[model samples]
Target: MTYNVQIKVMPLKDLLDPQGKAVMSGLQNLGLSGVEDVRVGKHITLRIDAETEEAAKQIADEASKKLLANPVMEFYEIEMIN
Candidate 1:
């Protein structure tokens, strides 16, 4: 079977996100005062061949941990969409 997977990778909450802060500052400078505590993350979508939904999810999780995300500085979430 084929499965669609979605992964979200983000910096750890305790870590400083300079890119996000820079964007937030830019937004504030552009007169968007309501925006606060902005955080930036990556959303990845991919197709995987697996026998079951659970297997697909496991593959996604493994990929996220091993390659897509930096375990020391970032975290990831995986979702399987059939």
Candidate 2:
């Protein structure tokens, strides 16, 4: 079977996100208050042939570790759809 995989890569929680901060401040200036602690992340979409969700997850994990995320300072999440 084929599964659609989506991987989201992002900086660690404690890391600085200047882009997100700028957007947050802009939103506040536009009268959109109560929004805090914004962070930006990347999304990757791909297709994989796997027998089960677990297998798809394993493939996504390897891809994330090797290419999608910077292991030293980044975190990642995976979503799979069949």
Candidate 3:
């Protein structure tokens, strides 16, 4: 069986995201108000061959830890989708 997985990678809350800051600045320049803050992140989708949802989730987690996210400055969340 194959499972669909989604990974969200984002900078740690304690860290500053330069890209997000730039985007916020751009938005303000465009006259967009009421936006207090912005954070930029990456969304990754993967199809994994596994027997069970748990197995697939584990694989995705391993992938995120190994290469998808930088543990030093970033964090990742994984979800199994239909």
* Candidate with the greatest lDDT versus the true structure: 3
* Backbone clashes under 3 angstroms, per model: 0, 0, 0
Give lDDT tens digits, candidate 1, residues 1-82.
Answer: 9899999999999999998999999998898888769889999997999898888899899888888999999998888765
Q: What is the C-alpha lDDT of each candidate?
A: 0.90, 0.88, 0.96
Best by the TM-score measure: 3
Ordered by TM-score, highest first, the candidates read 3, 1, 2
**Residue pairs in steric clash, candidate 3?**
none
Name the better of 1 and 3 by TM-score.
Answer: 3
Which scores better on TM-score, 2 or 3? 3
Measured with C-alpha atoms, the lDDT of residue 57 in candidate 3 is 93
Clashing pairs in 1: none
TM-scores vs. true structure, each candidate: 0.94, 0.82, 0.98
Off by over 4 Å in 1: none
For model 2, residues 1-82, the per-residue Cα lDDT tens digits are 8889999998899889887899899999899988967898898998988898789889999999998899888999998755
lDDT, candidate 2, equals: 0.88
lDDT of 3 by residue, 2-47 (tens): 9999999999999999999999999999999999999999999999
Q: Which stretches of candidate 3 lie over 4 Å from their true place?
A: none
